[model samples]
Target chain A: MNLNNIYELRWKVLPPLAGVAMIGMAALALVTAPTEVIEGDVQRLLYVHLPSALASYFAFSVTAVCSILFLLKRDFKWDSAAQGAAVVGLIFTLLTLITGSLWGKPIWGVYWQWDPRITTTLILFLIFSAYLIARKSSSLDSDKSARFCSIYAIIGFLDIPLIHMSVRWWRTLHPQPIIAKLNPALPDEMLLVTLFSVLAVILVAAWFITLGVETELLSQRLLKLRAIAKINISEKS
Target chain B: MSEIGFLFAGFAVFWAGMFTYLVILQVKIRNLQSQIDLLENIIENHDEV
Candidate 1:
């Protein structure tokens, strides 16, 4: 097939492939991944929670990179990409918070805590949310809105590192990094499942961001057409 | 609630959140598609005149 056919085939295959991977990872995590010796079944939440955190990090990183590109190149395409990534990052960050809470209640005997890790993560969520709000409030001018959001995305990314380091840098109820460390404390089966879960989450995050970007691009196109139509009507009058 | 109850809740919340987001994406895409079509039609008619 030609290049266009190849591109079409890739897009057609990706969503289903990512969906299947997500299901398989979920099954492995919930059903087959080995239980923790200490935390028992409650530890199973790691399969979802940790991967969600990882996916959020990946999403935010994409936002940061795209935001930088938008700043340098001044292209709406990069702005759309940055906006999409920020949205995905926000959703996954919220998911991480919810799942972490659910996991915490049974283990820590509390649904919420003011631990450094938890606090920083909440801040991260709030930051990206503000980026979305800025995007909305500046809807009157697309270029100015994109530039503002790009700057917001870049500045907000500073929180990610602090969130990642909170447990290590301060006294906190949250546990230190396990899978992220050079020497992880996971067993073979658990480690395998964790890796699989991370992969699946990344794939799903990519799909979400791609969908967001496509929708944004289409909306932008429609907006341009409306503007043109308005100008035409004004000229005729 | 039992430990198992918490576990089930976690799974339920995760799955439900993902499903809801997926549905939202579809709805937004559909709305945008329709809007694009309408705008395109309006522009085409204006050009024809």
Candidate 2:
């Protein structure tokens, strides 16, 4: 098939694939994974919590890379991609905060604390949220806006490393990285489910980014077409 | 609330957030698509003229 055909095929295929993977992951988390003795069923939240955090990291990483590419190439395509990834990253960050809060209420006995990890994550969310708003509200032209946002995104990405190392760098109520060690803290089945959850969340995040990029490109196209139509009308008159 | 309640709430919050974002993106995409279609028609007609 040609490139357009392949593109159309992906647009049609990805949504259902993401949906199925998510359902399968949920089943594994809820049914197949063993319950923790101490935390019991509440431990199941880790499946979604950890995966969403990782997915947000993935999305923001995409944004940061695309932002750099946009600066190097001065290509609007990279800017569009960076914008798409940022929006997806923001949504996932919001989900991480909310779910983490829910998970915290039970384990920590408080919905929120000034813990290092949580504080840094909240900062990440706020930075991206401001990035999106600034993209819309800026008085700059399109190219300048993209350049500004790209710089902002790269700077904002510095927070991810901080959030990742927060648990290690300082004493906090938050748990350290479970899967990052040579020997993971989770049992075999739980680890398997968590891995599957990460895969499913990443698939969904990819789908969202694709849709977001399409929307951004289409909007740009529409603006160009409108400008052309204005010229045509002015010439006719 | 109980442990089960928190578990359910966490999952519910996740699904709700994902679904809401998906809906918003879909709506925005649909609107842009329609606008593009309208502009394309205008440009094509102008070209024909």
Candidate 3:
């Protein structure tokens, strides 16, 4: 197979490669640290929620990339990729909420808290959901839907950094960016493991989005082919 | 009584969820491939006539 086949490319190779690395990082975390004095086993929630959230951001960023490409190239494949990533990003957003809530029960003493980070995350989720809805309104012309979805996708990407900065801009209890490279607070081991986890999930996200886009395109191709076949058979009869 | 244990469980669930999704996608792609193949065979047979 030629390099043009995504299956033959390096980026496509990342899922399995990163999967192994993630498992290794998990092992490192498992061995190096003692149980937290307070959150106990629950403290592990940090690793899950943070990485999931980061992966969600990464997915939306890819959506923006695809959306721009679709508009510039006028290629349907890029638009399909944007749609695929948006759906996956939305799922990861929900995961972030669930695991965050699970962690909150132990640390914040409440199952739900209206923290800055939490609120922005919720908004981000809603925006993407709306993006999907806009993509499939059924009444719009195909060209119109593609245009609107592309526009909405660009809007969604612009919202991500605003979501991140909201916690600092407002006096919220979400603890002001726990992980920044310039001035770090968490122990190096913990931070490294968490970063590794983020990278792992991002690879998983890319693999998923690529597969999804190809599947959707294949379905469309199938539908068109079948319709043509039916027409030809009826003409013969 | 460790922060790390919760940490471990979180990672476990996340990885498991992603892996399951990947497996599901694999199955779906296989199914679609079969459908496409069958359709193509029908079209080819019809053309032969």
Candidate 4:
């Protein structure tokens, strides 16, 4: 099949599959997963918060890899993919912060904290936010803009490691990594639900990045077409 | 708010944010598609002329 047909097929197939998976994840989280003895229902926010955090990490990793590829290959497609991943990463990061805050309120007695992990996460968010804004507002040519953004993305990705280690590097209110260790902190049932939720969020993030790339490429095509049309008009005049 | 209230609000915010982002993305795609079509038409007509 041709490229357009493949793109069309993905567009048609991904959304419904993602929707159903997310619905199933919600059921598993809200219904099947046992509630915590101490925190009760409010602990359920972990289902969303943890998944968002994982998905954001995945998305930023994509951006970092794509940025490096763009720098190496000097291809606009890589730049487009990097931009798409960055957008998805930003969305997931925002969700992570908000959901984490909500989960914190009942457990920690305050929604906002300057704890090590939270602060590092906030810094990560700010870095990406600045990356997007700089990318959009820059007056540089396409190649220059892409190069600048690619380097910015690579630098911004340095925050990911810091965010991951913040809990261990300092005494923080934030809980340490639960599922990442040899022995997970969560019970089997809750761990299963959390895993499913992470899968669902990652699926959603992939779909979003696909849509974003398509839109960016279309915009690029439109710009090229407009430039050609302008040249034709000038010649005719 | 009560614990249940917090629980409900957390889920509600997550769903609402996801839905709103999807809608915004759809609109952006639609707008970009139309602009692409317009620009392609302009280029084609210019070529014909």
Best by TM-score: 4
DockQ of 2: 0.83
| lDDT (tens digit, per residue) of candidate 4 on A41-97 | 998999999888888888888889999999999988888788888888888888888
Write the number of the candidate with greater TM-score, choosing between 1 and 3: 1
Give the poorly placed runs of model 3, Cα more than 4 Å off.
Answer: A1-7, A10-12, A34-39, A136-141, A161-184, B1-12
Tell me the spans in candidate 4 whose CA falls farther than 4 Å from its real position.
A1-9, A139-141, A162-184
Model 3 CAPRI rating = acceptable
Query: Model 3 clash pairs?
Result: A35-B2, A35-B3, A36-B2, A36-B3, A40-B2, A41-B6, A44-B6, A44-B7
Q: What is the TM-score of chain A in candidate 4?
A: 0.87
Best by DockQ: 2
Ordering by lDDT = 2, 4, 1, 3
For model 4, state the Cα shift of residue A103 in Å: 0.8
Q: Evaluate residue B1 in candidate 4 and report its C-alpha lDDT on the 0 to 100 scale.
A: 89
Q: What ranges in model 2 sit over 4 Å off?
A: A1-9, A139-141, A162-184
Which tens-of-lDDT digit does each residue in A40-89 have in candidate 2? 88889989998898898898899899999999999888888887888898
Model 1, residue A196: what's the lDDT?
92
Cα lDDT tens digits, model 1, A1-237, are 788686466457668878998899879988898777667787888888988888988999998999999899998878877788888888889889999998888777789866667777788898898988888677724787788888888888975676667644664454643322222478888899999999888888888887877777777777787898899788778
Q: How would you encode candidate 3's per-residue C-alpha lDDT over A101-130 as one tens digit per residue?
A: 767765665667666778888888999999
Looking at model 4, the pairs that clash are: none
* lDDT, residue A23, model 2: 99
- What TM-score does model 3 score on chain A? 0.81
Ranked by lDDT, the better of candidates 2 and 3 is 2
Interface RMSD of candidate 1, in Å, is: 1.1
TM-score per candidate, chains pooled? 0.88, 0.89, 0.81, 0.89
